[model samples]
Target: MEVKVKVWIEDDNRNLVFGSGKNEILKYVELTGSISKAATKAGMNYKKAWSHIQVLENYIEDKLVITKKGRGEDSGSKLTPKAKELIELYNQLDEDIKKYSQKRFEELFLKKDELISLKEDDAS
Candidate 1:
């Protein structure tokens, strides 16, 4: 089966509010401490990423991520307390889902590749 599986929270319209796009941005933002770097990681331009971040900020009515001045000559971005919490939660949930899905898939599909038996009536 061709399937695109995703785990996310939906908005009032049942649209994904936290999908790969947003999560990837968050990961890069956390890693590089720069919006530019994060945008690069996400295969987007810095200006676009900045605009997206602004949209997110406006949507939640709070700063999900923050940029700060780097010490000694450079500036960087930083996650706010809430952003950290959100990241931690996402990590935990991702771990749990991966563990569960792996176990379930193995148990159901990898045990022996059992054959499917057709019903006697359907054989006619």
Candidate 2:
């Protein structure tokens, strides 16, 4: 089956923020070692993105990213252990879901035409 999968956490504002995006931000933080650069690549302003990170940290009850004062371009931002774990979890969950979907729908359900027809009719 051709299924699309999505995973996210909803905020107090009912916003569906993706684990993937946050993970990418963490990756960029590690690569560039700057929250500012990470936020920019994520198409977010630094302060606003920082605020979002803060919200997530509060939700998880742990610090995700840490920033440091730069001494003439020798310092920047980095992801904490919590952040790495969160990202790894996000990736693992996503993979598991995808695998399950393929096994359940594409393989197992492919032969179940009667059930699929009923579902399609109900949708229409």
Candidate 3:
């Protein structure tokens, strides 16, 4: 009765780049300005979050985060301009794809007009 869609990007070699998980982690980092905090909010540990960022960077061949080494509150992380752009573009494309997919699904499976034209063969 409903559709679930997930959008992700992969490199030319099929390496994972960006997806919902990365999106969430990056958004959290953008919001809290700390990978540690972002990891916590995303329900993962700091190491896992850091590893994801590293993987993303490897596939994209760009640094997505800026880290300042300092003590306590002074230490924080921020996203690069490219990272922000990636997030925006990814989100837009994902929304568009999901919308189109849903519309197609309804047209294919739930359209009343089509149902009216269904022949006996369609029942099988």
Candidate 4:
């Protein structure tokens, strides 16, 4: 009855880099400014969350966040400009792809179904 899609970015080795899951983690980190807080918010283990971030940064060859060593407001994780850009681009691409897929699905599958259903209704 409807179309669904899951989009992600991968490296040349087909390594998963960015997707909805990582997107959520990054968004939470961007909000909380702490990996621990982000992990808690996402209901993920802190180590797993950190590992995921590490994988993303390693694969992209960029620093996704900067963490300062302190206990005051000046010390917390902050997303880099590149990380923000990557998030924006990935979100846009995912949305655009889903929109295109739904449009095509309607044109091809739903339209045909409507025609067939109408034909049956007329006969009955």
RMSD (Å) per prediction: 4.7, 4.1, 3.5, 3.8
Residues 64-118 of candidate 2 have per-residue lDDT tens digits of: 8877895766567878898888888888988898888766776654564433543
Checking candidate 3 for backbone clashes, the offending pairs are none
Q: Quantify how close model 4 is to the true structure by its C-alpha RMSD in Å.
A: 3.8
Model 2 scores a C-alpha lDDT of 0.76
Q: Give each model's whole-structure lDDT.
A: 0.72, 0.76, 0.88, 0.87
Tens-place lDDT per residue, model 3, 1-115, is 5567888888788877789889889999999999999999999999999999999888779999999988777578989999999889989999999999988877776766454
Clashing pairs in 2: 1-106
Q: Rank the candidates by TM-score, best first.
A: 4, 3, 2, 1
Identify the superior model by TM-score, candidate 1 or candidate 4: 4
Which residues of candidate 3, in runs, are more than 4 Å off? 71-74, 113-124
lDDT score of residue 29 within candidate 3: 96
Q: Which digits, one per residue and each the tens of the lDDT, describe model 4 over residues 1-124? A: 6689999888888888889878888889899999999999999999989998899899889999899978997899999998898889989999999999988878875754573343555777
| Residue range 1-124, candidate 1, lDDT tens digits | 1113466767898855565567678778989988899999899998878876676666678797766665744468877777777678877877777777766765655535652334687566
